[model samples]
Target: MSLVVSPSKVFRVAEVILEGGIAFAPTDTIYGLLANALDRRAVERLFAIRRPSGRPFLLLIPQEDWIEELGLIIGPRQRKLLSLGITLVIPKRTSVPLYLTRGRKSLAVRLPSSTAGFIRDLLKVVGVPLVAPSANPEGLKPATSVKEGMAYFGRRVNIYVDAGKIVGKPSTIVRLIGYRSVRLVREGNVPFREVLRFLSS
Candidate 1:
């Protein structure tokens, strides 16, 4: 019972999201369930699907440049490096809820490179940052298609946006240790060498 979708139908999907429904949608790396990051109900639904807790979900922004406005506690050095397409997980002091931050002072934030414009515009309409992790349970293979996302989430998610398969693996993850130091959390599409070059310079 998979539904095939097109780019023209993004607005339809957005409407569903506005009504407080979760969606399985395509990304540059894989299919991810998108919901209003600020909504506790939506986040609860996401956690129910993945049975995940203790670990915080990553927030994906549409534009790398928008990180400044969205993040209240990013350092100047971290902001500068992030503008170059580096994924930065930095500490934040905000009322964004401890559930989203996993009771930690830090938050994992990134601007997806490939779907920057489309995702950014979608978020603008939704009026919330998107909390998107892999569309699968923790420690499992990330879904690369709508079918995979459905398989993992089943009827937990309200809708599906099928846009074919993803091009590659997951996005790279790096945590800002100090002003200029970043630790590799997970190596995926972005190589470690490239990340090093960005932080070094």
Candidate 2:
């Protein structure tokens, strides 16, 4: 049976995720299915549940330094865009696992926004980055509430961290082309124009 937790019980949520358990919880952008990114078995379990169609899931890091650790070069522009809650797609270091990158040359990664205090605390307590894909099967809308999450994942997921209804859209995804510009991968909650303006400034 899966456990349902309130936003206040983050320590318990951390425990489950650290044990290679999958948790459906609220992210900075939308509700996501989270597991330890470093654990291959845990990541496989997340894939089993998500059943992504050859697309890789995004990783959420607690700090900017982790960008380099994950084999991506982080520059001033990358730092600025990430701080504004943008997801970055950059060339993957050969060391990144095939499961995480899905054999792609690049991987998408995000740092939780300061506003997502619950998720930030959860990552801090878990002490590692998490593979966070939106809470839904492929081709379906992401769950905004725990009940909707339950409907999609049922007891397959280990923990459900409810933060009420999360109506927020997914994070804006982008790829940096040069020092001066970025390519929009997907338009989500963040405006592409705003990202361009931030880079241009």
Candidate 3:
């Protein structure tokens, strides 16, 4: 069953995950069901919930600076492209499971401006990266509330943090093509205009 919780409850949710369960959580954008990225069983359960064949999930991290740990950061031009607020999928050399990577030899990673500190601390304590995607089925609009998350996953998830409403848009997604160039993959909260301004300067 789903229960609305508070930031203080993050510790409780972390406890549940330590026991090998999953959680539907609130982020800046939408609700996401998160699991230990390296846990095979957890990953399987996540895929089972979505029931997708090949769609890949994005890995949320606490900081963008950590990109070096996974893969090389794109060059200035690519970084400029990312400044446009697009999500970038890049190659990584991490211990994250191949399944989590979807056998793609890379991972889509992002450091959300919201909840980054909280999630980062939690992951540090858990000793693993958290894998999170929109808490909805493939091709469906993402859920923005605890109620919506529960309605989507029901008892499949262990807990839901009711942090109130979320921004309706998904995160902007871009992929690094080279050191100085990046491709816009998906546009969401981070506007392309703002991104261009940031990268240009």
Candidate 4:
């Protein structure tokens, strides 16, 4: 444990993240480590906490248009993917920090489609995009509840938001290699058939 916290104040937790602190909270998919994606210092701390150096984290934005804030473009299908709760690996902007993409020129991101109201509201307040990697040491199972995450991180994280139990599988990851050329990097919760249908549309 690092600092005393009030888990019930979601906005306060959001504020912590805004100030370069890492928080543990249930996301649209699972419990994850939340930090300001654009803050290199904060992001570096997140990498240290998550174990293994240089693992790419998915950025969680509030809206599809926000991707442009990082100097990337968004297409209709890409927007559609968000509606489907997909983690999109899109081409990265040159302006984005090397830390975020591990010196690569592409980034993985999503606009969280959380069913939980509090999570959504918190995301709304944060405004800035956040890196939401599953809350646990590297090579361990992703946490589905605050209790599960506490077991993994103890008090290393600044805040914890419990949305009961988040049992959904991880989001499917798709890489936009080329225009209209989408590739599956990983399959978890999203059905492949639907992806096919989306590609065909």
**Highest lDDT, which number?**
2
lDDT of 3 by residue, 1-201 (tens): 555677567678788777777888765466788887667788788888874776667776545555665554456555444323246787666564578777776678766554354555566566555778878888787888777877788888987777777766778876766565556777788876666556657
* Native-to-model Cα distance after best TM-score fit, residue 21 in candidate 4, in Å: 1.2
Worst 10-residue lDDT window for candidate 3 reads 77-86
Model 4, global lDDT: 0.79
Candidate 4 clashes between residue pairs 3 or more apart in a chain or in different chains: 1-155, 92-106
Candidate 1 lDDT over residue span 34-110, tens digit each: 88777788887888777565587878766555555554466566665555444578877675577788778788886
True-vs-predicted CA distance for residue 91, candidate 1, Å: 0.5
lDDT, ranked from best to worst: 2, 4, 1, 3
Question: lDDT of each prediction vs. the true structure?
Answer: 0.71, 0.87, 0.69, 0.79
Residue runs of model 4 more than 4 Å from their true location after superposition: 1-8, 114-116
Q: Looking at model 2, which ten-residue stretch has the lowest summed lDDT?
A: 70-79
Report the C-alpha lDDT of model 4 over 67-138, residue by residue, as the tens digit: 778876556655577767788888866887788888777888877766645557777898888898888788
Which stretches in model 1 have alpha-carbon errors above 4 Å? 1-4, 63-72, 84-86, 114-118
State the lDDT of candidate 2 residue by residue for 1-201, as single tens digits: 999989899999999998989999988888999999999999998898897576788999988888878887556765688788789887767887798898898888888888888888888888788999989999899899999999999999999998898898788999876554679999997899998898877
What clash count goes with each model?
0, 0, 10, 2
Give, for candidate 1, the lowest lDDT window spanning 10 residues: 63-72
